[model samples]
Target chain A: MTTNKSLFLIPKFITTPSQNGVGRYVCQLQRVVLKFCKNHGSSRGIREFIEYDLLNFANKNPEVVVYLKPRRHRGPVIKAEYLNGDDQIVFCHNNTREEIAKWLNLLRTQSGNHDGTRLRKLWHTDYPSIQGPWTPYTFRDPALNLAEFPNEELSRPLDQPKTATEELDELFKKQQESEVAESSEVK
Target chain B: MSVLKRVQQWATFARIWHVYDATWQNPFQSAELLKKYLMGIHKPIYHPMNDCGDHVIVINSLDIALPGNEWAKRVYFHHTGYPGGATWTLAWELHRKDPTMILKKAVYNSMDGNLQRRYTMERLHIFPDGNVPPELMGNVSNQIRQIRPMPKRLDHYTKEEVEKFPKIIDYPKDYILR
Candidate 1:
């Protein structure tokens, strides 16, 4: 229910490049730099991630280049660069070791810096329709293409009820037929 | 974008031209019907923000019927910026001044008053008769049906057809014809 416009105001787009895992998989995350202070209290999560999970992560994805920068008293930060020239920074102040591992995984999988940006559409396709897109003439009567404009046959309403004059004419015809039958029986 | 995709975009958003015969059709009723085509509400891809409306050419505006006593009772008001410049015109009087005004107003008032209303009205083309210019008529690909059936007059029947019609009562030979 928050009415903040910052998330909504960001440019929206669909994934265009790096259609990975179809025939070949190329990891877009080129390099990730983990910045943290050795003695700061906020860098406890970073220190824990480096001890328990950093070696496993580096061995799993040898394509990604990981660099550690130990500052004097700065907070923890993760700076990731993509092959598509997108640079993203995640501030990990007071974050747990588990949260830091999840953030690194998300950055490795994404094609670009997609944080704070919205997806314009949920669906994407190379061939949008198998039956082709609709045009004005789709399902239109072929006879109309040859017919002239303001045609009387086309102008009349589709459903027309019997008029009073036609009803009266039908009644008179029935009466005449009954009278004729009576005269023929006498003969 | 590919060449085929660019052409597909043009085909989907093309504006269709429609012709409607207003003979014996009530202006108010026809307005509601025409409003759909004028604003592209009848299409499957209709969106309030999209510019997908079509052009409507109305013929025989002079023959449009007004239900009940609306011709006399309906009042159209107008005013100038200055004082004592207000005037009220009856529907019949307005029709007499401009044959297409009544129908035009009916359609104009049928839609919601918004910034797009004026632009939507610009696509409507009204003619008093069927004598539309060749340029406009050439673009018409579809015809909108009339709301009511056109009543047939006695004179419209052929002489032989009228003579052969069944009669309920016969006049005496001695009785003179009027």
Candidate 2:
């Protein structure tokens, strides 16, 4: 289920393997949206789109459990702090918790719009590494607070598990050793 | 609290992609803006866990604008890694030589380390004219629902050329949802 009210459509530019391309594309794209919003009254048009969609959906059926594919605990990506070898760093977020809280508060406080989304029922749309057999995390953020962003642990040090290639190499080595032993026994 | 929410959840898991575009004073500025638009950071939907950006289509690559004499002065570097294998070309050379690859290459340079972004970028379409060929139009791609930058007939570029750029041609607004 989804609502037009506040689904943050962050365009993760994973189209090209080249890092420069992603940045270049993002930069150009930002300008366009800025221009569009400027020409079309920017956020106002967006607000209108949201109101129209929500009202339309509500009219059809009052019960709407819209699942938003939003960013995880949108906060600051602070360099991980390792405390007593108990470093709890996770994914690297762009903003810190304070910044996120500030933005959320600011967006919510503004009476100009259809009541900002305000982190309503958060969900983390996972993007993983290419070589990774991505480990699945639960959709429901148990620690999520409607008024608050996720804790600073948003930027976690990605302690990657055994990679696919590494695992394959290990398997190959074991097989090779077994074959060698069998040959030696036969000889 | 039913098993069906899982089914509903499964049904709801959309393969949602992003779409971004820009019309610059010139291709340089256009490509610059287009880069940011496709990256999804511009949108509120950005997620670190998942790269949430969409498929971007950059029209009007030929007319990209550059600051000052960047077109003439800006040089792109390439390394062969063999003695004196390094080569360089000015931005002007690239645009004229291929034109299509200039903006694409510019963007490629910007996205340095993100390997996943490399895949999501396949959705991007860069055309010199507003009227791109039919194949480039978003209508054909099931993932691309609408053509943003709304397909205008830029100066001298034909409507046909614009249509060619989008995956869909003569598509109704409701075509994708239907």
DockQ (CA atoms), all models: 0.63, 0.01
Candidate 1 global CA lDDT score: 0.93
Model 2: what is its DockQ? 0.01
Tell me the TM-score of each prediction against the true structure.
0.82, 0.34
Model 1 CAPRI rating: medium
After TM-score superposition, what is the CA distance of residue B108 in candidate 2 from its true location, in Å?
2.5
lDDT of 1 by residue, B115-163 (tens): 9999999999999998999999999999999888888888999999899
Q: Which digits, one per residue and each the tens of the lDDT, describe model 1 over residues A27-124?
A: 99999999998999999999999999999999999999999999989989999999999999999998999999999999999899987876767888
- Deviation in Å, model 2, residue B155 alpha carbon: 10
Model 2 - which docking category? incorrect
Q: lDDT at B11 for candidate 2?
A: 35
Residues A1-187, model 2: lDDT tens digits: 9677456643332222233344452211110010112122223332333335434533443232222222233322211111112112222233333443343333322222222234433443344334433111224344432312111232122354665545765776687799999999999
Per-prediction fnat: 0.87, 0.00
